[model samples]
Target: MNDILIQNTTAFFEKSFGSVPQKVVLSPGRINIIGEHIDYNDGYVLPAAIDKIICFAFEKNDSKKSKIIAIDLNEEFEIDLTQEVKLSKVVWTNYIRGVIKQLQDNGFSFEGFNCVFSSNIPVGSGLSSSAALECGMIYGIKELFNLDIQKLDISLLGQKAEHWVGINCGIMDQFSSVHGLENKVIKLDCNTLEYEYHNADFKDYSLILMDSNVKHSLFTSEYNTRRIECEEGLAIIKAEFPEIKSFRDCSEEQVLNLKNKMSEKVFSRVHFVVKEINRVVKACEALDQGNIEVLGQLLFETHYGLSQEYEVSCEELDMLVNTAKDDDAIIGSRLMGGGFGGCTINLIKKGHENDIKSKFSNLYLDTFGIELKFYDVKISNGTTLL
Candidate 1:
């Protein structure tokens, strides 16, 4: 897959620029093992970079004007570095423009360049394809320009770029894209940018992402609403318990106590975060002890909390996760990413993967008329030049 992607990107670059690309970057999408919707709440999220990636080829034009080609979408966008940064009308171009804008805003000046890119990351699947693009662009540019930037800064810049592009996302996607290590998961603190990598070697089990191929229109608005609701509940709790700093520090008892003061919606959101945060803690411990069965149960608990308590899930997602209860081979399964519609990350025994995929796909098609696409993913290194 890497070889084909590299060959295709290089060929496209040569065709577009009449010469080979000076640099290439591959940035992988991410998966959160347990914690969800807790990153902005100052909770730790365990995420790892996956094999799904966005590939890019870049070369300096040595001119103010730059052209970018989205090889997959067959779209072209052009910009001039000398001009003031403005948001692009084209949505995808904004990712490219956002990264460039972030670089300039940080006083990292460099000339415009030509780029061609392709991606295998499924769109709207909650794999964070946008982060892969943002990180890939910055990493390629940094290499092409010999810029003195650290990996952590690369993540922050990609995150800021997304905020500029109107996503208002947390840092997990970009952080995992830039800091991921092969065969490991990073236990990262969202508050202090502190992290440690844990071995992710599941001896007899494998990870797979089964995309529901269903996206609810309410995702963006509800995502913002979730953030606001969490903050409202957190403020209420902090007022009662002055020692409580964020949802990470707030106890389940404290949240339950303030349920009357806050609305049911806000209360549920806070309740989910508090419990989900503790689940992350236990999940790390479970992995440390190589007790994957405990980890799988924790994932199921998180799905319930997300679907019921947090109220971010839809009927399709509920149905998808519901099917897992019957299959003993399927240990862990949940609606991943921002909730409404996307993929469910599952951990199942190696031999039963095909049977599970076949069963799930047929069920989805019969029930919803949408095709279920499953991806077999491995823990892979972060963004790198190839």
Candidate 2:
């Protein structure tokens, strides 16, 4: 366990329950070093669970009330066992509520429990903090209640909770939260939900996350719009290519043939989706061969397409990506998450960590006048009760 996580876990149980809990649960935040906006396309994504995670302390309560406290957010919520309340505001509490609702929907018997959640995962960094929190809660409840839930089942349950809470996210976040392994990236097929676990062992290399600090307000709205455009594009392609199951099934030639049917804007969106699908395939090949150069180049290409074609990247994202473009020590850099803001994932030489951080920090400060936070992340295990 990480030091901060250990400290937080120890303190959470001591403060909340006045004693050490029977168990602790950990669910990690994920970094999609590549494959942004491709999860919904039914394409492959390379995501790893970082050491940063949400740690929870819990114990079953005698009463039929589930009590949850968010130490970091300074919020507490309670729900009666007999009824579920849907709140108008979407706060940290809804995440817990969603989990309860999902379990109830599945006909699982659950009683009230006291859970205290604390995490070092930076919220709104596109690191899947929400998923981490949800998964942690699920793990804690499962352990405290002695519920026999499989990891995959728990992951799907968490996804349902997110959907219930108004964010129509794909299964990637939840999948990674549950299935993540140390020093590995999950290559998930969003359509079939079939996934293969692979190692991203860039020897003498590390992944650096550069937080742009430019909060993405349009993530919710634009995310839905992008999905709609992809569906529309799918319809256009399906008219000719009836065999096409998803954007992943269509080739560049097929998209070009139906290019006339879509607007330039839609076409651009389709273009990024098509190329991103191909990139994921190639990235897997690169991962197997351990070619950091090829992987880095693909990351740059993805950011470019996301910026110019998909139009999701903002100036800060663009500047951060371009700043790392020419550096030899850096192989790949791309904006992660729903775009507009968040961090760019960079594959850097392990020895050049300070150099890259110093260089990027100065570059970002001079250009955008905003300081960037660099998270030196390591691939870590996913959700588990301790």
> TM-scores for all candidates?
0.99, 0.97
Q: How far off is residue 329 in model 1, in Å?
A: 0.9
RMSD of 1: 0.8
Candidate 2 lands at a TM-score of 0.97
Q: What are the C-alpha RMSDs, in order, of all predicted structures?
A: 0.8, 1.4
How many residue pairs clash per model?
A: 0, 1
User: Where does candidate 2 stray beyond 4 Å?
Assistant: 88-90
lDDT of the candidates, in the order given: 0.91, 0.86
Q: Against the correct fold, how does model 1 do in TM-score? A: 0.99
Worst lDDT window (10 residues) for model 2?
A: 84-93
Q: Residue 58 deviation, candidate 2, in Å?
A: 0.4
Candidate 1 displacement at residue 318 in angstroms:
1.0
Which stretches of candidate 1 lie above 4 Å from their native place?
none
